[model samples]
Target: MRYRPVAFGLAVAALAAVSLTTPAQAKPAASSTTMANTTSAGTTATRVVTAAIPFGQNGDIPVARNYSGDSRYEIAVFRPSNGTWYIRGVGAYKFGQNGDIPVPADFTGDGRAELALFRPSNGYWYVRGVGQFTWGQAGDVPVPANYIGDSRAEAAVFRPSTGKWWIRGTAAIAWGRSGDIPVPADYLGDSHADLGVFRPATAQWWVRGAATIAWGVNGDIPVPANWVGTAKADLAIFRPSTGAWNLRGTSPVTWGTNGDRPQPGNYAGDTGTDQVVWRPSNGTWYLRYRVPITPPPPPPPNCDPSYPTVCIPPPPPDLNCGDITYRNFKVIGTDPHHFDSDHDGIGCES
Candidate 1:
């Protein structure tokens, strides 16, 4: 069909500003800025860049770059009132403000796209897909004994342990298939189960924090916070020395060393108030978050040179391909490059 790969980088940049205009009234021209350039490849290839441009006079709102691909775009919004941020994605043209926005991408090799959204009004995050779309709470969101100004909240994108997106907030993280109930004690990380790990064998949810805690059916444990979340489950790992966890995904549902064990926390918010806590023993104090199970790490990437080593060349070009190419291109211009063509998984993994 002789198709021209859309200008992904430019389009995402250009359109990002146009999408987030304030609805209250037409204000001054928003700030025009560039984010990063990304690359994608397949039968056809093109470059894609995602920019977070200021949309309103205050430039407080952020919209993800516009692009054409199986990839899903996520945007994090901040509310100045509470200094809180929230994220939502899964839709093509509009933001998934209340419900899950569905974007199609086979990030986990499951052959389907995952959609998620964070709703600050109710302090609940929602996920939708081929199977289910349900809402779960982020753990630490201070339901504030009293109402606050506008109840504004912000969010960030999260790939849940369930091989899907989980929104992080000032509260707890919720995960699992749509319609499936999430546990309170399992999720971890920023108040909202924004980032976490899952232990399939132990069925525990772990999160990165100053202390890194592991959440599971039995209880939560303390781990290193160096590990980051990734698209694949279980693949998330942590370093013993730096105490860093690799980016695997939010739902790291497996435990390696200790079966589900609880971590210690200060109930009265005092370091001196330190007390050992566990589930069932203190259910009210704990929150639950679902995570996708992951296979074990890939045998240390076969560092053994003696075995057959497959040499992988640098990645090919990224031809932004999809229906929104033209629409997104008009907005982005080709000047700076912000694309991750290598597809080693890390965006701009330079």
Candidate 2:
């Protein structure tokens, strides 16, 4: 059975307006907008671009296209400390003309999600924290997932040309008979995102995880959410024709109008996914959840206080005459000591 969580209080408002800057001025900086504490039921929402990046520290940053009619885009980061969102950075983009939106994921395994955009000019995918790499294939749909059980998420794409899904995470490729909609989710609660696709023709969602099956129908714009409170991501769809959201185990929600984009996230920090819609008509964001809550940042990684680097055995000492066991504890650098059995400079003679 599909799991559905209890619906929290719903609040909706328009976010604060952000000033636009040129690409040269788009460095990461503190926001200049004034912050105010929002009430439980009423909070001003900020207008943002269609793409959002989860800050990993419990808040999300929204990106917006240049309102000045330039090719540059502005990114507004939500400051949990002040309960306000502000413009954080700006950059020129090629996606605006190509109709591609930026893809956000934790590609560096740092818990903080980064932004990535596909460059139609070079046929390469450019990731924010990571560098640009060749994807070769052409597709607009991008699925950010951790298909290899690693903490780092990889960018996956669905190529409608071949009706196949190519995952850059494990370099694993799979084929599906139909569907070009990209759905990256942790359908098994495994802490790793899996590959999924939605066939709008049949309104069926197919997941490649513990529970792989065809479910739902006539679903467009697949939105993954923990609506059932299972701690596992489930599928939700926005029917543009009716502006209704059909979430599993819950009644249909008449929320957005046509041309609105659905962005599902844990905006409330309740561990259950909530709904946020971006209406292009007014460039305003509409949220359907309780008062926004920012989760505490995760504890720092375990590192040697002095070195400030991950602790590991130092390199082994170079030796020619004794059993390797004797040099087990000896380290020359950060690696365990190595023995030169052949009297050559190279360690381990290999």
Top model number, TM-score: 2
Native-to-model Cα distance after best TM-score fit, residue 88 in candidate 2, in Å: 6.8
Candidate 1 segments whose C-alpha is farther than 4 A from its true place: 1-67, 70-115, 120-134, 138-350
CA lDDT, every model vs. true structure: 0.27, 0.51
Q: Residue 309, candidate 1: how far off, in angstroms? A: 37
lDDT of 2 by residue, 1-350 (tens): 12132111111123344332213322222233333333344554322112233221223335432222232233343322332334434322221123234555667776555555554454566554356666545553566677778887766777766667677634546755544576767877887776677777766667774444455566467777666457678778877777788787666776678877775665444445556666655445555543323456998664323222223223233333243323222223333233433434334332
Task: Please identify model 2 stretches exceeding 4 Å from their true place.
Answer: 1-18, 21-101, 169-171, 209-219, 291-350
Candidate 2, residue 164: CA error in Å? 2.2
Candidate 1 has its poorest 10 consecutive residues by lDDT at 142-151
Candidate 1 TM-score over all chains jointly? 0.21
